[model samples]
Target: MVNLMRYRAEAVYREVSDAGPGSGVTGREADERYSPIDILHDIGASVVFMGDVAEQLLGDSPVWDRVGVVRYPTRRSFIEMQQREDFREKHLHKEAGMAETIVAGCLPIDPPAGHLGEVAWDDVEYPPSDGDGPLMVIHVLRFAEGDAEADMAAYQTAAFAVASAHGARISGWFGVEGTIIGDGRRWDQVRFNLFPSRAAFMSVLADPSRLEAQRAHREVSIADTYTLLVRPAVDSLAASIQSA
Candidate 1:
């Protein structure tokens, strides 16, 4: 079996908007705006073999605008894709389209210990798991807006509370500056969180019961939110959820 690390990477890019902070686009519109990034995904398919895509869900990196997830057959495969000539060429366009982006590499630790949730859709059946499971290492990116420090703090506080209450684990959180995306804009902050499974993430983001928590987040969030789910080369590590 391949000792692969699963990843959930998030990228956020801006659409032509006159709105300022707190203006969020609906999930459907976000999908339309993110449609352009699909080309670069072909590269992941080329080397990674089996992979999935999570459109705009959350911004974790400093300058992230668009996010994607890749599951390579091996670490070597992951590395190889990054170095591929075609991928390198395609990346140029990806860089041009986005203002900023965030990416993370993660490992899913069973019995998830610490983590937080940023956003989750309203009605969706997330991947199954018992809630307490492995830590899925994740990389995140966010395009810098007005004040990253203040924005990140608010995002972390609200999101963490939501996730923690539901039993998730957060291993670490860090910030990355600048990116190879080649856009004139640079990233502001990058965050990290490890969850037992996608279900945990969904619970935090979707729970209608948490209306107060969601309302509390009104000030610190962007209208446009995106999320991507990625996995490692190894298949067995996939989290298994019980049938409802």
Candidate 2:
């Protein structure tokens, strides 16, 4: 699941059945208290990555504070965990602190192959970030009304080509199955690009190939999108997934 959270300035415990963060507390601090690790353990789920937003690269969506990617053993396990009394008690903090949240159940969807012949994704060497460290650029996208899929595929193919050249990888490319938490707005996909450094990501923007792809496919395909850059405390979700 990919979580996009927008926290309130002050936590508000409204009609919550359980005790949680009270007044005068900032939402971020309050939410910090909402850990239900025991429930997660029981369900065999784990947090893959969690981080604070470093910057917004694109989008008209309201600014969000935090991002999370969680892996679950099964969807049923997730639902059962949510219903557990212990988890519900702790959930009050999230309920009180969150102004809005969007939790998208995701499944990996690799970008189309064959474009980068003889250069497989696995063969690409990903080096540790230099300077301030690696950053993940996340994109939440909603496709346009007509012929969007074809256009997006072409765009992703072209975009991936440019991204790979800049030492970036598609860390998580997901198709949103459903929205567990949302405010009516819907999304089609969520893509993540892990870059070695801020400097490298900046270079991706200046690449002429990226511009050509945007004009040729991206602009026509995506109707709405949010592109966020974040420095995750857990740098590599792929490592965790692979080990699991």
Candidate 3:
């Protein structure tokens, strides 16, 4: 809960600035956008907001390009929020403005511990902790041929703990229910972790603890793992939004 609050405040502070593509939205304009989101803070507000606003502003309707996530304090709170008129009307409209969106519910994993080494979290003029690509550890996991529910629950339990301990700042995680594009298969679990640096990431991979955990997890958790070395670049037109 403490971590959630800290991150929320951080997001609000960081978000309420020239973070978006500069279409001339001054400070005052940004404040207006954040007003509604801020009021919902204490009502179990741990969410991950992501998308390519640039693409959005261009009027492209590419699917999965924009999203707003709201995390409730409990399942009950989530249910209540979904039922609330304000939540339904305002939230849905805000989302509809986007080109594409998907909403999901999930519980957090445990602390990630096994890692390679520590990187200077402050070295970069701008840290890619949340925006994109510090190092994305993508896992291709699948449940049993029939017992999908039981398999997913077990994977989440172990993944959360291990990820948190490894100093992985989880942006968010989700489970896919329907068929994925290109394949008729369904992905049971998806997790995203942003490491401080390449060395920091390697540390976890080489850790004895991580190795042991990997061995245990391989038994029932993962079908395959693909590492995408992504480095999200600040678009050429977005040069004015420089980091302080």
Top lDDT prediction, candidate number:
2
The TM-score values for the models, in the order shown, are: 0.39, 0.87, 0.41
Candidate 2: tens digits of C-alpha lDDT, residues 1-244: 8999999898878664443335477788778888666678778888888889999878756788899988888888888887888898788888878998999998877656633323443344444444557778999999999989898778777777777765676666789999989988889999877777676677777778888988998899888899999988875677665565
What C-alpha lDDT values do all the predictions have?
0.40, 0.79, 0.40
Q: On TM-score, who's better, 1 or 3? A: 3
**Tens-digit lDDT track for model 1 on 1-244?**
1111122132233333322234444433333343323434554322221223333344444322223333333455556667866656544434334333334343333332334332332222343345533334444435445654455456556666676654454433334322433334343333334555666666776766454544554334433333445432322222211110
The residue pairs that clash in candidate 2, if any, are: none
The TM-score leader among the candidates is: 2
**TM-score ranking from best to worst?**
2, 3, 1
Which digits, one per residue and each the tens of the lDDT, describe model 3 over residues 1-244?
A: 1010001111222233324544544333433354356436646454333222221111122222222334455666655665766655444323323222223344444433433224344653334455434554433345445444455455445544544454555543455444312224444554545565455556656666556655554445444332333332321111111210
Instruction: Tell me the deviation in Å of residue 194 in model 2.
Output: 0.6
